[model samples]
Target: MLNCHDATFLLSQRLERDLSVTERANLRLHVTICRGCTNFERQLPTLGKAARAFASHDPGAEDSSS
Candidate 1:
């Protein structure tokens, strides 16, 4: 039974496939009942798209891997 706050926190990480089964299940349960979290889920993809666009536009940005 994850709360809205927890759901938002987990949403992106889960989308990245970084969450454990238990955490994913909890987030799913929260999004099932919380409209706000559900909306947040809907908007998550938009954010990812924006981030991808930004990175694509900044090819010369310093690599963080070093």
Candidate 2:
């Protein structure tokens, strides 16, 4: 059984590195039972995409606020 902190940490870390078999199993179990964690997992991809877009945005490329 994993606490929310541990489960969330695992979720974030999995994006950066490969989780062990046991880690994946534990995280899956935790997210399956935890609604908040489930939502967080589902939102991870969208958040990642948004972050990449923001990072690559050009502040001076165009003036849209007129």
- Which candidate number would show the highest lDDT if scored against the true structure? 2
Q: What is the TM-score of each candidate against the true structure?
A: 0.70, 0.79
**Residues 1-66, candidate 2, lDDT per residue (tens digit)?**
999999989999999999999999999999999999999889989999999999999987777675
lDDT of 1: 0.85
- Give the candidate number with the greatest TM-score: 2
For all candidates in order, the CA lDDT equals: 0.85, 0.94
What is the alpha-carbon lDDT for the whole of candidate 2? 0.94
Tens digits of per-residue lDDT for model 1, 1-66: 777777898997777678888997888888898999899899999999998898788555676556
